[model samples]
Target chain A: MKHLVLGGVRSGKSQFAERWIAEQRKQIVYIATSQVWDGSMAERIAKHQSYRPDHWHTIEEPITLADTLKKVASEQPESGVIVECCSLWLTNLLCAENEAQLTQEREQFLAVLENYPLPVILVSAEVGLGIMPINALARRYGDEIGVLNQRMAQICDQVTLVTAGLPMTLKATQGK
Target chain B: MKHLVLGGVRSGKSQFAERWIAEQRKQIVYIATSQVWDGSMAERIAKHQSYRPDHWHTIEEPITLADTLKKVASEQPESGVIVECCSLWLTNLLCAENEAQLTQEREQFLAVLENYPLPVILVSAEVGLGIMPINALARRYGDEIGVLNQRMAQICDQVTLVTAGLPMTLKATQGK
Candidate 1:
């Protein structure tokens, strides 16, 4: 039941993914990776927070993603798990200001994906379709995230893209 | 040669679509639908503006979408377009508050899309992949946008999804 949901900003991708989780008949752990470093983001994050059911356990991991997922979802067999998003985690990884640390963190994150248990669902942004970033760092970030996404898509059992609020499964799955 | 690029917020989706446009050897029109109603949006809009060549014709149409596209894309064979995004337009349509008007407007948009010449690439968010929305309007807006996206995907020559800064073209040809 591993799933990948990808879309652009305000494209209704998040609401679609959340609805999917609400319908699932398993205990759930909602993993959110947002760090409120600004005012608007704080507001937006708050809006998102108010939408979840109180009973659904949530773990906020600004970093340390692999370890967090392993710790939270390792024991839940029947319940599904969600990594709310990947783009922020990638941002956090890229902006660590330590190049070696960034590489090590990314590799560790990728390594954790290999055998993580639970029917994991990941929400991530599809950011490479727009423009060629004019800066060196933005381009590098894009490339690295692109690689990470491809690996996720290859490993995940399903890949879903929502546009204009519609959900269309790219890597089709038969899960109810 | 029509194309649509879909991705998540800050997902580098806009940049990806912009890069695709920058590579085009044809005359270009940049249709920006974003309204800089606040400071954050203004900053983002400014960042995007800095990326373009000085000669590319620009059209700022927050409404009247079909008429604008038809007007700008009518003349040349080698003309291509980039719609910076559809989310704002979706919001525009929602705020119109007239179901009949929204229907008429969207129909006009589809009509304009029907016979437009050249490669027009639309950039939109892949929203609706998250939890169920809290309000009726939000839920309805999500559904409406989803319908619009599927219709556009059906008509366009190519549909690509970007996630974590990577893109995979799901539908690459018209009527496929």
Candidate 2:
């Protein structure tokens, strides 16, 4: 079983996932996808790092999420694999600029999930659920991430929405 | 074939790997394994993020190394899969506290390299080559990561030692 989380900014989605991952088992591995390009984002990244327990393994990946997930999953498919959110990942994928590469990378990431070996938990932002973006690229990103999430949800055994520090199960097939 | 990089702290190993990954004959996907927990690390992460070109795909994973690699290998196994550094990751795995889980994870991580789908590169610190540490845990980590790297070097197709921004191939094997 895998848990897919979606929510808005400051929606407590990451916190929910972190706390949950910490509790799942002793061998916790946190997969972070955020890149600290600015002071604000740097602060955000630091805060996320400080939250983890000392023993949890961490791999800093700004891209190649699907590949990294496969690596971890293949090694410990039964262990917890928590990727904070896929929204940023989708953004990264679409930002590849080359249309063919972007499409190819997208398919590759999806394939990683499709053949995922363990109980993987993923968190992503709910793009376009509230409002459509005015800018072309922003709108495209929103649409793209929404599509990515749907593609993932279609295959995920469980899906949950995190709002106001609350978790409402969306696709709960079998909660392990 | 994958190009391996081994070095000490602040030796520009990551920058070297980034450059190599960027100069690849295929699309680039960064598989990061660092998470932010403090102001210092956040700043470091931000600096790295800011330096990256806008077109590359980024995947944020603080953990789950083997699974991610396998997925990328399966998707683009022939291109390149350069995973930056295994020191921290080995530390993360050893911190599991559960011997069974630790051994399982270690075995799994090592096993993925045997018949991986892609040409892979691994960046790791030569921690043990330096002076022994004063602290017990620090020394343990140094020892553990050192052993991990040595074993990886044995299985890897090629190994390179990077010192003062120069790379010397220590071991080489033709990849299938």
Candidate 3:
């Protein structure tokens, strides 16, 4: 099953996705995309780490998400790999690489979503629901993230949008 | 019918609300909460005005929304009032007023929602689904908006969440 979970900041998307995937009873591979660049972010990361079972294999990969997924599949075919979020991964790529490089990475990631082997749950931020950002960087990030979510939703089997700590399934697999 | 329409930017909340109210065949009092403080904002306001029906009465009230609503109800109780958005109204209050003034204004607005005489439709932005803002002002705005939405949702007769141009009814009057 390929599931895409989306929400705003503190929308309980990560916790919801985690619980849903855990219910499947598969060995979990938690693919974290965040890098602790600041003190607050480090605290956030630590808080997230505390909730998950200590045995869940954790992989910290800010970029090269597609490559990491491929490697995980080969090593643990039966395990469900969770991509903690696409927004932070895109942020990393946006800041570190040029447009072409980011495009290449995004394309590769989408291509892999087409026929992913393992049960994969991709978490993403739904950031387009507010006012037009006053800053250029935030606007650019919103545009990229919105486009990525649409493309990912088209390919993924299921998509859930969380709001106010509630999960609403926007797209679901038919007859499953 | 009092309806609260919530969505992210470009999620079509305004259009959806406009269309819904237009279908009711009542005169609309478009209570805009934005003041054109800059060139970009002027453009945005102009663009919005262009799409709306020419005959619809428009009122630009950045603050004193509750007072304006009261006046509108008395002057044109038969007409439907559309508060263009709560987010902008809150933004106006956040910037111009002290905490005490803002609280009084917010309380008055909620008090009016309890039994709004005329058919009213309120629009708001659902902005909590994203990364924690990096700045203090943005963070404060997000927190305020989130709490406001929750309180508004509890009071409104109907709450519709718009996503990608579709409206999902989150709460609706029973037997309606």
Best by TM-score: 3
Q: lDDT tens digits, residues A1-176, model 2? A: 66788765544678778777666666777888777667856976887788777877888776778778878877866577788767776666667677786787678878887767666678887745433536677778767877888998998888876543446677878644
- What lDDT score goes with residue A7 in model 2? 62
* CA error at residue B71 for candidate 3, angstroms: 28
lDDT of 1: 0.76
Model 3 misplaced regions, further than 4 Å: B1-125, B129-134, B143-167, B171-176
Off by over 4 Å in 2: A76-78, B1-176
- Native A-B contact fraction in model 1: 0.07
DockQ each candidate and list the results: 0.06, 0.01, 0.18
Steric clashes per prediction: 46, 40, 6
Candidate 2 falls in which docking quality class? incorrect
What overall lDDT goes with each candidate model?
A: 0.76, 0.69, 0.86
Residue-by-residue lDDT tens digits, candidate 1, A117-159: 6767888876665443347677677666766777787667678
What C-alpha RMSD separates each model from the true structure?
Answer: 11.0, 23.7, 6.6
lDDT for model 3 comes to 0.86
lDDT of 2 at A25: 61
Tell me which of candidates 2 and 3 scores higher on TM-score.
3
lDDT of each residue in A61-117, candidate 3, tens digit only: 999998999899899887888899899999999999588889999999999888898
lDDT of 2 by residue, B28-52 (tens): 6667677666899889878887876
Candidate 1 residue runs with Cα over 4 Å from true position: A1-176, B75-77, B174-176
